[model samples]
Target: MAEQALANLHTDSGMHGRKAERFAVNRASRILSINPALSGISIRSCHLLDISRVGATISLVTTIGLSDHYYLNIMGTANRIGCAEIYRNGSRVGVKFIKEIDDELLHTIVRGDFFTAAI
Candidate 1:
């Protein structure tokens, strides 16, 4: 039953194939979307499960059809990285950074220091 549910989400989001190296992580993040028609931005809370230099995996707090492009506001940092959805399964979704993050910031995220404001 669990597998079926995941499969449904994966197909529903249109994430069927992928090839990338992902690093395991667990952090809270905010997903931001811009609405051109309304000229507003919507925010959704999510969990960051894993990350790589190019992309990261996230699990939404609720099932919502995210835009193809969005921004991931990592907690404890003022930085917001542009991202594009690449894959999904249930609440879990994979996203690739629109631009590569600097090595220092990448290290900080991988070291699990995202909660620290020192960055």
Candidate 2:
């Protein structure tokens, strides 16, 4: 399912072109905390489809009521990124980080090191 979403995004005519290369991390299921600092409402689960330093693609059960801005918590690590919605298609959403994440953290996530941090 995650792979299909990534492929759809690539084929989607609306893509403006990506700023950074994305790394496939479909094996991880991370948590999406909606405006955590403000509301503390967290979605049960969302899969990390692909990621880059600037943004990521997540798979959700439903996009309903999702705000334009939210916080994504990378499950196995103490990392939370502020994200702004770029686009949503069915259950997939493309988001851009409010601030770029460092390469070390990006590599850590791509390497699947956070798997041990998952609860």
TM-scores of all predicted structures: 0.72, 0.70
- What lDDT, from 0 to 1, does candidate 2 have? 0.71
| Superposition TM-score, candidate 2 onto the true structure | 0.70
**Top-scoring candidate (lDDT):** 2
Q: After superposition, how far is residue 44 of candidate 2 from its true place, in Å?
A: 3.5
- What local distance difference test score does each model get? 0.70, 0.71
Q: Which ten-residue region of model 1 has the weakest summed lDDT?
A: 4-13
lDDT score for residue 16 of model 2:
64
lDDT by residue for model 2 (31-83), tens: 55556466667664788877877788899888887888877887666887888
Q: Model 2, poorest ten-residue lDDT window?
A: 5-14
lDDT tens per residue, model 1, 3-103: 32122122122234543334565667999999879799989998877676677788996656578899998886677999988877888888878886776
Model 1 Cα RMSD, 1 decimal: 8.5
